[model samples]
Target chain A: DQQVKQNSPSLSVQEGRISILNCDYTNSMFDYFLWYKKYPAEGPTFLISISSIKDKNEDGRFTVFLNKSAKHLSLHIVPSQPGDSAVYFCAAGKGGSNYKLTFGKGTLLTVNP
Target chain B: GAGVSQSPSNKVTEKGKDVELRCDPISGHTALYWYRQSLGQGLEFLIYFQGNSAPDKSGLPSDRFSAERTGGSVSTLTIQRTQQEDSAVYLCASSSRAGLNTEAFFGQGTRLTVV
Candidate 1:
């Protein structure tokens, strides 16, 4: 079963606009969430993360909002640039255990210049 | 000084053959993990290793797949009797500690193709 799910397979956004990607998880044990951006032939790079303790975490142009009750999370990039175009993966893990991350199918975000 | 490094960026092997993939974690990092992404699939957790602790092998698909971390610095993932279904991009990652809410650095990944 897919514990984590990214319902959207792909997303397209215009430059300078805001891009939002959403993810959902079925495992209630997951308390930590992370977002990674990946390019072709490259590994996923860590972008932002949010602990269950907080509802939101922001870094520079990227922000992640988590809703534990809903078991959902979203990543928002303001003033999206072409460089931000890549596959975005949402991963989650349960704390204090082995905490091996469970990943979603990933969303391909394309930004138009 | 460097990030996680995985060797043999790409490998092609025939069915029924055995393949060994290697990973070199960042110096002093105590946590390492292995994951694989198959075609049109999400990243699948394979195994995990922490400093001196019993490795987590629950994610391993079968007995054909096994991994060992030696000296707590390097890891090798061996796939015995490879099958076409085993084809995927295998990724390795490392973190400073285990079971913490910290991000793990990833390697470029090793693409394995079984024909």
Candidate 2:
């Protein structure tokens, strides 16, 4: 069973617009959620994260909103730029345990000019 | 000073043969983890090593797989009698410590092809 799932295989957005990516999970144990951006042949880079205690976390143009009751989360990038295009993976951890992360299949976001 | 590094970026071996993949975590990072990525199973945790704590091997798939970390700096993942199903990109990551919410830095990863 896939504990985490990213239903959208890919997404396209216009530059300077807001790009939103969605993810869902079946595991309720997960408390800390994070977003990682990856390029071809490169490992995923940590972008932003949100603790279960808070509904939202923002850094620069990236913001992550989490809805625990819905077991869903979304990543928003305002004024998206071409450089923001990459495969985004949503990962979650239970923390306090082993800090092991479970990642989604990833959504490839393309920002067009 | 440098980020995590993995050797033999790409390895192709015949079935029934054994292959070894190595990883060097960042200097002073007390936590290391190994994972496998495949189409069948998005990404699965293989193992983890944290300062003297008994390594977590629960994620290991079978007895044919094993891994070890030496001097708390380098780690090697060995596959005995490889099978076609074992073909996938193996990733290694490390963090300052296995703290509650510290992020991990990953290596480029070693792509293993079992032919």
lDDT tens digits, residues B1-115, model 2?
4888998899999999999999999999999999888754456788989988899998889999999999988999999999999999898988896732346888889999999
Residue-level lDDT tens digits of model 1 in B1-114: 478899999999999999999999999999998999998788898999999999999999999999999999999999999999999999998888774234578899999999
Per-residue error (Å), model 1, residue A105: 0.6
Best candidate per DockQ, number? 1
lDDT of 1 by residue, A1-113 (tens): 99999999999999999999999999999988988899998888888888898999999999999999999999999989999999999989886353578889999999999
True contacts kept of 2: 0.36
Candidate 1 docking quality: incorrect, acceptable, medium or high: medium
Candidate 2 Cα outliers beyond 4 Å, as residue runs: A95-98, B99-103
lDDT score at residue A100, model 2, on the 0-100 scale: 73
What is the two-chain DockQ of model 2?
Answer: 0.48
Those runs of model 1 whose alpha carbons end farther than 4 Å from true positions after fitting are: A96-98, B99-103
Per-residue lDDT, model 2, residue A67, is 96
